[model samples]
Target: MADGILYGKPISYFPNGYPLFIALLKLIFSDALVPTILIIFNIIFQILSQYLFFKLLIKLNLNKELALITLFFVAIYPNQINYTRQILTEPISLFLLILSLLMYVSNKPFLSGITGFLAAQFRPTLIFLFPLILIHEIISKNTKKSFLLGLGVILCLFFFKILEYFNLILPPDNLKFNLIVATYSDSFNINWELARSKLSIIKNPLSVYINHLITNPLDFLEKRIISLWSLWGPFSVTHRGILEKILIGIRFPLFMFSIALFLLRKNLLSKNILIITYLPILVITFIHTMFFSQQRFTFVVEPFIIMHTVLYLYSFKGNFLNEN
Candidate 1:
């Protein structure tokens, strides 16, 4: 797609923002060098994201040692590190999303909005977070900050519109296709061919989803239950290597353990900061339950899980020592 755009054949698909950015890079440097450059950028983004994650932990009042432990875990997580080898949106999107949350906690709402907008361009599911943040600010009675943040997002949207007007890029044109594929359970396979068959007959994808919910409520619930498992479970429907499978197996239990701890001990931590961190994670998880769910999709929010888990472990240790 980036090559097509460079050669004057821009195709409209789901969120071309990352490809468009890649095209810009290709225009600047030789094609051979672009891959190397992207790998370097991915590494840099990962490093910066870790730094911001640590900063966020401190801002939320976590002890330095515990925060460093969380940072180390995030830095070494297999899924997080493996993506740097490929030319994918995860690295940049993760960096920007973490930076946005840091800015929000630092009381820089405008900067938060700008980074959040950039993150959403790479991963459109993040767009749900902006309205949630806006509502959060309004409820907190920070009207001025809310307005500035909203203005920042609106300015970015205007810039996107200008790009669209000049044909520099195209709007997302694959929502119906995504929705159709999402309707099918991905427990065994994606079955896109079957989804396409359904899409051909269905005029409105939204109505199809709604009618499915209304007619076969039990089936709808079952599919969603499978999707939730697909999103977080250690097993995969597709084939994976033994080493990759082991990493996922380790990660899944840790994620669930951290979540259980957080639920039981949330009141003991900084509620506001933790809420800010968890809100997007919850939103994306819910959205995918309706659409499609995959481990890669869940990767965007795994850092928070790491943080929560590490925090809980340290707190537990401290309490144990005092008890002794």
Candidate 2:
């Protein structure tokens, strides 16, 4: 409300996905209604996303009963609903991601590609989902179709960048800034003093970052790994109070239990629905390992986490989770 919608340069520096959506609402309606409408729409979108996710679980051959259980957990999930009230990308990004996955599983590759492209615009890390989808297609022996879909998705992502290159859009170049900040800490807090001091001596931000990273690769890895931990689970988002605390308490153990089951079942090594479900988690993890890591930034992948957790506890049917 204060600075208005931000984009480009010294004043505001970020992608335009979430803000553009809000801006469109503001243009259509009144500014006063944007907040209330945004919150309401986000809640609705999240519910829809959950419904899609439940169907996805069923398609993956999870027991119908367990899929409903997973839907219940997702509907009531504290971390997810927490972002609905705020003017942030998490809600919409999550919605788009689930929609994309649903489209893909339903054999609508072109639509899935479009939805995934939108999700990545909201949260850049989600762009990694395309490669995972490509891998899934390869494994499913649909390489030609995956290639075309991926190409379309890539073109969508590069469209804006190409426009910017031609001086069409002026979104701020935040990559250098992100790299510079990464040298300090995994947290989003920018050490301006340190950054400014370093900038004073450096001619090129990218060069300095590359040199530092080359010299201290271990330190870079350590900070990113710790950041990923903070971003993934209960630590990432703020809890409301006692009720949320209880939910996290329940969720955490289930999460841990699921992880154990995932490994014991060798879900990653197997060529099945488990691998398809698991690959996105790895893709997002690797994306954060390289970019600015945060809870809200990676919220797009929460459904996958919740799905696997519930699946593990329920144990659908056969020895294999994937009926395909």
lDDT of 1 at 55: 88
Query: In angstroms, how far off is 211's CA in candidate 1?
Result: 1.7
Tell me the tens digit of each residue's lDDT in model 2 across 1-324.
Answer: 212542322123566566567766877878688788988888888888888888777777766776787788777766676777777778888888878777777777777787888887777667777777777688789976687678668777687667567543456445556667777756545476776576557667777667768999887777776666655554434434766545544545555655766776554324446555666677777766665565555456667777767656555444424445
Give all candidates' CA lDDT scores.
0.79, 0.67
lDDT of 1 by residue, 211-245 (tens): 88899899788888777777777666569888777
> Cα lDDT of model 1 overall?
0.79
Top of the candidates by lDDT: 1
My TM-score estimates for the predictions, one after another, are 0.91, 0.80
* Candidate 1: residue 214 lDDT (0-100): 92
- lDDT, residue 83, candidate 1: 79
**C-alpha lDDT of residue 35 in model 2:** 82
Off by over 4 Å in 1: 3-9, 185-187, 196-201, 319-324
